[model samples]
Target: MNGDWLLRGRDGRLTVYLPSGEAVLCRAERGPGGPWEDAPRTVGGTQKLHPGAAVGQGADRYAHLAAWRPTVPGESGLVHTTHFRPLLAPLDWVPIGHPDKKGDRTGPPAVAVDGPGRGYVFVRNAGGGVSLRNQKVKGGWGGWLDLGGQEIEERLAPVAAESGRVELYACAPGAILHWHQEGDGKKPVRAAEVEAAVRPGTLRALATSAEHTTVFFTDDSGDVCAWRPGEKPVPLLAAAGPGPVSAVRCVIEGHDCTVLAQRSASGRVAFAAYPTEQESAGAWWTESGPQLPSDALVAVALDEHEELVAASLSPSTGTLLLTRRKDEPGLALEAWREI
Candidate 1:
């Protein structure tokens, strides 16, 4: 499973998106530390590349994949599964067009879904700006709308924070490019900048609650930073290398906390946490996580209860090894049960 993306679906399962456009779904047991189960086959009937995961509510609660359209050669497309189903067989795959006029676009399209099942996909076109499309509730797919900007330098994925308002973000060179839409029937506000950038492909975001969405990425100096809306980016602990960054909002020691994890340049995994009620973003990060053998860290996702499910490519097997922590109260990294 040369997975490219990790995301948690509304069904409380962690989904791993592979380079071949297939997906593997894992679900936890009723309690903490038992065996986890995976679907019998590859879900999401996608035969393309750069798979993205988008989970919406109600009827649209299924996992959506936005990837390079293998059928169309150079364009991108959108496909979705039935809500909360075990097998993520495609409900529909729509060719929504690409951002660039030519060549494969950077990475897979990023998707965000609203409470009512409205979906938005973002792609960095060959023109260097971002291209977007919308799927309205009870309506068909809309046309491509170019939100022009050449500063986006990499094939970083996009994350959407949906509350009453919906906000989207992408990693740009030395900044975080953002977009948002508020109110019914109103236009979206686009491209707000947060001056924090890391190596391409390392940015990640988590919508902790309805009121707060935090973005994290390794900076140029190898330090991880956390950014919230209307606040400056807060620098946290340093990493040995710039790999991937992931965060999960969970209860630890009976208090809400965000567990931030990253892979060092040397291929070791590390994690740290801070209280959700803490006001300062510059809080220290404790190095209490378990180090695992990995070539590249793929994706990290949390279930409905905030139990973490992380996948990394095994250096020896070249397959995805899945791990989850025991359900206990401790800041230190718990022993991971391999699936």
Candidate 2:
């Protein structure tokens, strides 16, 4: 799946979810350091789901999954499922219908949960603008609200900052569109747009501060660039890789750092680590593990031990492969193991 597949729960557990056949299958660790469960658990009532799934976790420790499914023949609608406990059980899939009633047309969805545990889902609408739906205070959901934009790409990046404010980023024809909350409990309004030619399906955002986030994406020339709300785009690495890049912030050697992973042109998972938000300081990409079979989606997250964990689905075999960051040096990872 293009969206995040690796999730770290508030209880210090890691769970991986992926699309299997027409259902979403997940596997999670028994406890913190993980002797992960052997077989995959089928999320109840997701047999008709589409291929990709995007997952997000909230402050309440609930994991939210978003996917699209056929509501009627030739028409599709958004479906969501929430997990009360990690790897235990997920509630039934709830339908959040499309923004347009004439025809159920929407792109893949991305979800983010605010600090107070309310969840928000975003997708590109039929007219190529962004639309959002969020969880109400008492329960249930609010109606779909169109956050206007045009020619937006399918891949969306949504991140909730430490201030409990949610921010969204989308790639358009020749620029990146941004939206954010002005105050607590406020809906995100369209903000400044960055002029950059971003490659489709490559936008990724990481919250680098309490109120702001830094977005990373490959520019039209295949170079990786980092940009924040007010700052200019900072070019980080050139010819980094293909497909979307995965990143997570953590403490390394007592210094706040951001670690990134992407699929290299040679089919290997490459890694880079740098001081958080200091892209101009310079960072190098290093190829890690053996080359993957093809353009497998690579993802990274910090485990309970605060070590970096990278995961990807084996496109050739449909197996999940995982590797952890080595304790030694800059962004090194242990050997890859399948589960």
Candidate 3:
């Protein structure tokens, strides 16, 4: 996968980038009936799954992006070492197949929890209905579990890997399913139904935080709402600041603090933080939208100590990047620091 994740507080700026380094969907859905912004949420209302369309012949198709370090900051520098053309499945021994035989899968997205291959994957189709595929890396990628529910428009699946298990989540109209990965040797794990806050069938964003995973929903007001990991989700909190929030991220150890990054309809990067405590959800979390050099912020991340680290904001093309501490080289990456 050429794209990398720029994690911010669940209430701050968020974005996904292509291998070429250009970004897309960096903002949230604008006013009602609007197209998705260049921000980080999935495709919707005729929008294509990004990074995927960007991948074609001679293009680097991200086979799958794996690995995230939530506990450490330094580890954040390189979250995923993507597999190029000769795509390498995480485990070589496991048998692989396209969960989306219809080629609707925006590449394959799966959740592996526990060991090498004990998770479920929900692949998409343009006509509607998702193909649920389960597999045990050790055993084999189980068969595709057909989870036929009302289709969700512009839905992107997020997965979790741990405890020799994998979980797949998707949204359709009014219900959610906890579809488990199964195989020939293994029977399908019963799919559990859950509620998605707000309208029954709006596209939601999901990400895993080590052992826990959270789902985010963009409400009618265009404000971002979230659900709890592992358990039934409850409304957490709205990101603070005057601008609307675009995306939410959970920070891990040795990494940046969890962030909520928002971009206004006009194009501005607003950052917020996801609370370590559940009580913090109701209140608007603290937010900061420092006037950045760029017209848009492509990515946002926090360091372990909760200090804001790197952000791919619209750089002042005419401004010269000075030395870090007045002595650092003009070399990229090391040239940025708080003034």
Candidate 4:
């Protein structure tokens, strides 16, 4: 689907979810040192998922998945599934319904989990506005709350800051709309919009500090740009390719770094690392391994050993490919291994 296919749980396990035909199948590692399961396990009741799916892990360490199902009889809508444990068993796909009933129109969802382990799902409503539904403290879901915006694009990025406040970013026609919570467990209030021409489906958010997050997206020129809440947008890498860029924060050489991965224009996964929020320092983009299919999605995360791990789906072969950062040098990755 997109780059949100990989998830790292609080227990140090990594799970890779892929949309195979009509179902969303997953394979997770056994423990910290994982040889992932030999075969894929189908998430229960996900037989009608629309290929685009988003996943996030809550404070309870459970993986929450949101997907759009467009062919569900009379009214097409969105569905959600949560893993009961870290190892990928006991999943039930529950329908979350759609906001617009006339055309049953809804975009792919973006999920975020607050500090209290409640999950929130966001999507572009039929009227080109943003709508959100979240879980209550007692584990019940609230109704869809329209978080007002106009001409919003299909891609959405949501990040839960280290302080447990969740912030959302959406790309509108000529601006980037923002929504944030004043404090943890509070409703997200819309903030002033940032004017920028961002490429649709290329927005990603990473928490760089306790209360602030840096959002990265491909600009109109195909260059990657970084923007924080109240700061000017800083251009980073140039011509870094398309689709959603994935990022994870880790410590490298005793320095905190943000590592990024995206599918390059040449059909390969490219990576870059720079000091967190220090965009002016410049970043070196490196293309790793052989070329995957152009539609392949890339995701990066930290493993139990604190090593950087990257995963992607091979849509043509219906297999998952994985690689880890090499210890010897700068931004090097071990060979890609199919799982």
Shift of residue 253 alpha carbon in model 1, Å: 1.8
Residue pairs in steric clash, candidate 4?
none
What's the lDDT for candidate 4? 0.81
Is 2 or 4 the stronger prediction by lDDT?
Answer: 2
lDDT of each: 0.57, 0.83, 0.37, 0.81
* Residue 122 lDDT in candidate 2: 90
User: What's the CA error at residue 281 for candidate 4, in Å?
Assistant: 0.7
Tens digits of per-residue lDDT for model 2, 1-339: 645678877788888887787888878888987789888788756458877677887767678888888777888888788876666788888888887753665788899888888878898899889999888877889888889999889889998887878899998888988999897657799998889988888899888977579899999898999989888898899755778789999887788999889888888888888899888778888988777778477899888888889997775577678898788866667889887
Q: How many angstroms is residue 193 displaced in model 2 relative to the true structure, after the best TM-score fit?
A: 0.5
Clashes of each: 1, 0, 52, 0
TM agreement with the true structure for every prediction: 0.78, 0.96, 0.50, 0.94
The C-alpha stretches of model 1 lying farther than 4 A from their native spots are: 1-14, 21-40, 46-61, 71-83, 100-103, 162-164, 184-187, 277-294, 315-318, 332-334
Candidate 3: C-alpha lDDT: 0.37
Per-residue lDDT of 159-263 in model 3, one digit per residue for the tens? 443233444456665556555445332433545656654443333333434455555555544455655544665555543323323343434434323554544
Off by more than 4 A, model 2 = none
Tens digit per residue, CA lDDT, model 1, 63-129: 5545455446544444444335423444544566656544554645566555566666666776777
Better of 2 and 4 by TM-score: 2
Backbone clash tally (model 4) = 0
By the lDDT metric, which is better: model 1 or model 2? 2
